[model samples]
Target chain A: MQSLIVDLGERSYPIYIGQNILCEALIKPFIKGNQVMVVTNDTIAPLYLDHLLAHLSGLSVDVTVLPDGESYKDLTHLNLIFDNLLKNKHNRTTTLIALGGGVVGDMTGFAAASYQRGVDFIQIPTTVLSQVDSSVGGKTGVNHPLGKNMIGAFYQPQLVVADISVFATLPDRELSAGIAEVIKYGLIYDYSFFCWLEENIERLVARDADILMQAIHRSCEIKAEVVAQDEKEAGIRAWLNLGHTFGHAIETHQGYGNWLHGEAVAAGTMMALSLSVQMGWISIEDMDRVRRLFEKANLPVTPPKNMSSNDFIDLMSVDKKVLNGQLRLVLLKTLGEAVVTADYSKEKLMDVLSA
Target chain B: MQSLIVDLGERSYPIYIGQNILCEALIKPFIKGNQVMVVTNDTIAPLYLDHLLAHLSGLSVDVTVLPDGESYKDLTHLNLIFDNLLKNKHNRTTTLIALGGGVVGDMTGFAAASYQRGVDFIQIPTTVLSQVDSSVGGKTGVNHPLGKNMIGAFYQPQLVVADISVFATLPDRELSAGIAEVIKYGLIYDYSFFCWLEENIERLVARDADILMQAIHRSCEIKAEVVAQDEKEAGIRAWLNLGHTFGHAIETHQGYGNWLHGEAVAAGTMMALSLSVQMGWISIEDMDRVRRLFEKANLPVTPPKNMSSNDFIDLMSVDKKVLNGQLRLVLLKTLGEAVVTADYSKEKLMDVLSA
Candidate 1:
């Protein structure tokens, strides 16, 4: 097992990675009290909720399996968890275990943050996407009608348990979804990791343990180093959102659940690369490479057919990166290197966007 | 104006106390952004919202007055603020001004904290209760069905504008409610302040600005000291909740909005004193003095009718203060000092609890 610390001082926590870390004794020390609430979703509920439940057995535990979708990640669903915790008499000391992918982790982290003005929560991320991305960052919230993650807190979890074994049962579509985000780590900040993912795409799809584990670990190392430096996403951290501004617009425009988040982000990354080329920061050859690498992973490379270009731009204006009036984009200047800037003009953006 | 700084580093804020600060240029320099949302209630909206709106006419602003009452201090109310903010296309940089009592301040502050992962907010407290307590602590949240202030954060405002002139039109019952929290400042951590309140209780009720402002400044100083030591309520901060444990039970049991929160706290403070004497922490003469003070302020001194002892105890269990299995209580050792301990026999607690 490999233990990585987030280094947030008093709020700092650990992310344990390995095949059997879930059953390992390292985590029991952080469990704060007797009551525990396991928050997962229907898609992930039938698979590994029982494995987590068996481990939580002599301790008082309650499990809530919400409907599986991004649309459900709103006030109604958050309230369901709140209702269960309160009805079951969970207190501030009660620990919450988020036992699924990004949606489950985000919602659970937020519910934990808001429940009783905050409580302790451990992340038991079951999907590759969560293991590599969402579990590492302290960002937590659901999408709103006006924007995605427009309401949330920068609340860190006490522990993140990335159990690789749980990903074995992910559906082809979901597994592919996780691969998109995995490729994102390479595309934005590491040309070498990009080259590595380019070479190992098939093995990862085949679920080769060594390659998959390395991808998870390296991605986490890169992310943890970035997050440790900028916990509040004030400056350098915004670079991590390479495809998210476009990703959020696509997801909101596509009506949340119609496309998985990472799938939208996959297509969004293509758009970001295209814009990077239009802005003269990167070569067209590099954009083609990003598209080809995504294709090899079976990821979507085009925007969803339903959303209007006008609507997409409007949605992007509300992105967290758009702090002032202008929208900021995290674009790639080269493989393994990214830049956060809003210097592109309307004409250039619209020309590239019309594609 | 009484300038008290609640120091929490980056989250630190200043609470300003005086009459006509809102209409004067005194509060203008602290106002940061152009876009502002004024959150108020029907009772306070009619009384003070116009004055606030008039003062804010030079800036880009909107006013939303929610249904009047403590019951309105919930997620639904918070959602209303979000809905309006989003509908107005107010970006994360917009400032939110809470222009009522504790209910308005709490919900607006929380809305600021969670809306787009936080925005700037200023406290324009119109009520005497808010000017002294809620405005300074940086504690913001709505009530849950299970308990009060159970879901909140320690989010500070940029500046607090307390206009004493707004209190001239305040109702007698509401004015008395404010006195209850005023008396609390003396009870928990300041015996001299307690003695002072005892001597000048009638003067404070008569709207003596010198005494009222003194009471506000001293209360803020004691609260500021406790919050500075433990901003997150990990220890010392909970002492500020001396009467709130039982106070919340009374508010929750009486069907919220039935009795003013300060009035409920007034009665609960007496109960805490009665138990303190029973536990040999204070003299019987102290309880007598507390009773006399509440009477002079025209505040309730008994648990409201129809609330059972069992209901109060059950309610306290879900409080943010009860860590693990212990029901932590902050009791006065003397008028000027307090102690927090869970060391009490169930039988002993039952005697005072069952009354």
Candidate 2:
């Protein structure tokens, strides 16, 4: 097992990565209270709920199974977790365990943050998308009808246990979706890692255990470093949103769940790179290299054909990244380095959106 | 104006208590962004919205008027704040101003805490219940169906402007409700303040500005002291919830809005004092003194006739104060000091509840 800490001072916690390590002993130390509520989804419950519960023995345990999918990530569904916690008489000391993908992790973490004005929570991210991205950062929230992740909290979890063995059951499309975020860490901060991804992308796509482990570890390490420097996304942490602003527009435009978060991010990352090339910050060849890598991972490289420049402009205007009416995008200064800026040309942005 | 600080290091903020100080200059310094959203209820909007807006010139401002009452303090109405924020293109830097009683303040503060994963908010608490209690502490959240304030966050505001002049327009019933909390400060921490209330309770009920100001100031000071030592209620902060566990049970049982929070708290305080007497902590005279004070203020000193011991036990079991399946109640060891424990005999608790 490999472990890395997201150093947030007193709020710091460790993330454990390994195959089939979701056992009682690994999770026991983090349980701050005897009463535990494991929040997962219908899809994940059929596969991993009992498996996770079997390990949570000798404790007062309860489970709340929500319907699966990104569309369910709303205040309505988030309330269900709270209902279960309150119905089961979970108190301030009770701990909540999130046992599914990003949607489950985000909602469960939020539930913990607000339940009786905060409680301890553990993140057991099942999908690659969650393990590499959502579960690592303390960013937990449910989406509003108008925007994605519009309502939430920056609540840290007590522990994050990422079991790589779960990926064996992930659908091919979902695996590709998760790699989009894995590729994000490389593009934003690590040049050498991006190069490594170029060489290992094929093995990662093929589900090679050794290659997948390395990618997940490297991705978490980069994320941990960024989050440590900026826990609340005040400064350098904004770099993590390299493709998210555009991706959120895609997700909102398509009405969430129609396109997976990672799929949108993959396509959004491509648009950002294309705009980077136009700004002369990077060469066309540099953009193409990342484009090919995303293609190789079976991810989308462009926005949906139905979406136009108007859709991008309208949706992007409401993004959380927009400050004082200016929309900030994380664009590449080079292949591996990124900057969050509204300094780009509007006409060029229009060209990319129109294309 | 009399000002005191809730010293929470970097999260610290000032509470300004005076008559009609809700002006642009006092509020403008606290607003971190150019965009502002004032969240108030229907009752307060017609009275103060235009007056407040008249002062907030030159900044981009919007208003969301929710229906007045505790019944509306749920996730559904809380969503209206988020909806208004998104509809108006409020960004991460936009500040939310909570401009009503506890319900509006709680929902708005929670909205600010969660909107875009947190933003700046200023508390312009118009009601006495809000000014003396809810607005002073960072405890913000909406109620769940299963419980009252079962979901929320401890999110502080950038500034708090308690305009004592607003009490001129407050109804007699609500005025008395607010004093219940003011009296609480005395019972739990300040014997001198309790004596002062004994002498000046009538003047406060008659809305004497000087006496009301003194009461609000003292209540805020005691609350600030407790909150500064334990911001998250891990220790000393729990004492501030002296009657909340019992009060929440009454509020939940009667249904929100049927009984004002402070009225329920006033009645709940009597129950706690009764329990304290049964436990051989405080004498019967001490309990009667508080009961007479509540009577003078026109606050209820007992629970509803319909509620039984079973109702109290059933509802109190789900309170946030319950730890590890043990229900911890904040009880008085004497007239001026309080302690939170589950150490009292259950039979003794039933004696008080059944009475």
Candidate 3:
């Protein structure tokens, strides 16, 4: 196993990445308490819950299985975890283990954050999307019907164990979804990693463990560095949200489950690049590279056909990034750099949406 | 206005205690954004909403008035604030102003904490209970049916403006409830404060502004000290919860609105004294002294008659204070000292519950 630390001072935690390493020996060191509650969803429970339980043997372990899908990420489903913890008499000293993809990890992390006004939680993200992205940051919360991730907290996890072996079970669509974020790291900050992704696209699709491990590790390294400096998105941390503003609008317009989070982000990344090109910040060649990467990963490169420019504007206007009533977005100044600003004109942005 | 700082480093904010200081000049300095959403309940809206609005002139201000009571402090009502925020396009930079008692303050604080993963909030606590306790700490959240404050976060406000003038409009029962917490500061950590309470109990009950200001200021001083050292309730902070474990049971058992938080805490404080006496930490005379203070404030001194020892055990067992499946409680060592531990006999606790 290879380890990288997300330096957050007292809240700093380690992210462990490797193949077939989900065991008690690996997870035990991070658990601060004796009581453990493993939270997973219906989709992920049967596949890996028992393996996780095997490692948690002889500890006070309880499990809560939620229904699968982003649509289920709401206050109602969040209550299931809360109800189980309260019912089983879990306390502040108990550690919650989120043992699934982003949906489960987000909700469980949020549950741990709010349970008794915050408890310890360990993340065992089991999908490519979660292992590389959601599980690494301390952003924990559930979505509101009015907006995605509308209610949440910046509560960190005790540890993150991303076992690449679990990615073998991920659906092709989901694996591609994870790649969307993988490409994002390169497009926004690292040209070499973008080129590395360009060369290893097929290897990643073929599920080569070594290449996949490298991608997850590199993505986490960049994220960890950004989070360390700006843990609360007070400044540069917002750079990591490059395509999320437009992506969330698509997800909200399409309804959460209809389009996966990374799928929406994939399309939104393209929109961000398009906006960059219109502003003369990047060459069409650079925009083409980002598009080709998403296409190569089998990710969506455009918003839904039915969504109008107005729909995008209305939804994006309410995005979390909006400040002082102006929509702030993370736009690429080049292939290897990103900046969050509202410097572009509305007509230019509308032109990209129209195209 | 007298100011005391809750020194939480970067999270630290000032607690302003005095009369008629709720103007735009006093409030505007702490607001991080121009968009302001004032959250109040129906009871407080009719009383102070106009005054709050006058101070918020020429800004983008919105208000959501929830039903007034502890029963309404749930996720549903929390969503009312969220709904209004989203509908009005309130961004993450928007500042949420909580202008009511503890219920409104708690929910609004949680809303700001969770809105787009956190926003700035200012507390204009109209109730003495909030001005002295909840407003000082970063503890913000809503109640669940199974338990009180089962769902929430430790999100702090930008500034706390405790307008003692509002207490003049407070109902007698509410004022008495606030006195319970004031008495708690004396009981747990200050012998002289306890003696002072013995002398000034009638003055506090009569709502003398100068005396009330002193009581609120002293209570905040002790609370701020404890919270600064252990902001997350990992150690000495638990001492501030001297009666909360038992008090939460009373609030949960009687149902939230049935027993005001201070009323239940008043009774719970007495029970804690009884437990202390059983453990030989205090004499019957000392217990009576504590009870007399509650009685003088016109606060409840006993739990509901219907709840059995089993009910208390089951509910307290699930309290936030429980550790490693053991019930941890904050009990008095003497009239002026408190400690939190699970190192007590079940028999003695049962005896107190039965009594």
> For candidate 2, lDDT tens digit of each residue in A1-355?
9999999999999999998889999999999889999998888888888889899889999999999998999999988888788778888888899999999999999999999889999999999999999998889999988999999999999999989999878999999999999998999899999999999999999999889889999999999999999899988999999888889999999988999999999999999988999999999988889999999999999899999899999999999889888998999999789999989999999999998
Reference-based lDDT, residue A45, model 2:
88
- The DockQ of predicted model 2 stands at 0.92
- Off-target runs (Cα >4 Å) in candidate 2 are none
| Cand. 2 Cα-lDDT | 0.92
Model 1: per-residue Cα lDDT over A1-355, one tens digit each: 7778888889999988888667636666778798889999998888887777877756888998899888888877888898898888788789999998888999999888888778889999888888999999788887678777877888999999887888778887878888888888887777899899889988998888888889998888888888999998878888788888888888888788888888998998888888888878889888888888788778899997776779777888767776557778898888778889988767877876687
Give the range of the ten consecutive residues with the poorest summed lDDT in model 3 chain B. B317-326
Global Cα lDDT for candidate 3: 0.90
Candidate number with the higher lDDT (2 or 3): 2
| Best-to-worst DockQ order | 2, 3, 1
Clashing residue pairs in candidate 1 are A189-A336, A190-A336, A191-A336, B191-B335, B191-B336
> Model 2 - which docking category?
high
Q: In lDDT terms, which candidate is top?
A: 2
List DockQ, one per candidate, in order: 0.66, 0.92, 0.86
Poorly placed runs, candidate 3 (over 4 Å): none
lDDT of 2 at A182: 93
Q: Give the least accurate 10-residue stretch of model 1 chain A, judged by summed lDDT.
A: A20-29
Q: How many angstroms is residue B190 displaced in model 3 relative to the true structure, after the best TM-score fit? A: 1.3
True contacts kept of 2: 1.00
